[model samples]
Target: MKEKYPNLHRMALDYLSVPATSTAVERVFSQGRQLLHFTRNRLSGNSVRAFLCLGSWMRHDVVSPEDLIAIIRQKRKRPSE
Candidate 1:
């Protein structure tokens, strides 16, 4: 098979030897699905791209849900007299 498909064999060998798994790819795709669930039938190309970028960053720990929720709560709170 390698002799018949040299490029594919090389690609397979390279992938097998890489340190990174398909986990990141799966995670990003999962996030994209989640983002699309609520926005299905209404998302533009740019909107989808933005969501994917944001989702990828979130997966990479650039943002925390707790902090986001706290900020939202603070903004929604009325000022004390």
Candidate 2:
């Protein structure tokens, strides 16, 4: 296929590589949208990423609420240099 029609083959590869459904991605985006809407633009990019990751982790039982609180406290106590 590549040898016969390089351009079409490249185009097909590009188009076919995309996912059939963006449900998971859209779900995450929706979550982020809700989060940002609540926070009202107070969060930075890094903070948003951290919050999203933490939310996903908590949802999956990878981190508990207590653990998250402890981690936040520990970070706050660390002196910035």
Best by TM-score: 2
Evaluate model 1: give its lDDT.
Answer: 0.67
Candidate 2 lDDT, 1-81, residue by residue in tens:
789976456555543555568996798799999899965798899998778776866665656899879988999999997
Q: What RMSD value applies to candidate 2?
A: 11.9
Taking every candidate in turn, the Cα RMSD to the unseen true structure, in Å, is 13.9, 11.9
Clashing pairs in 1: none
- Per-residue error for 30 in candidate 1, Å, reads 0.8
**lDDT winner:** 2
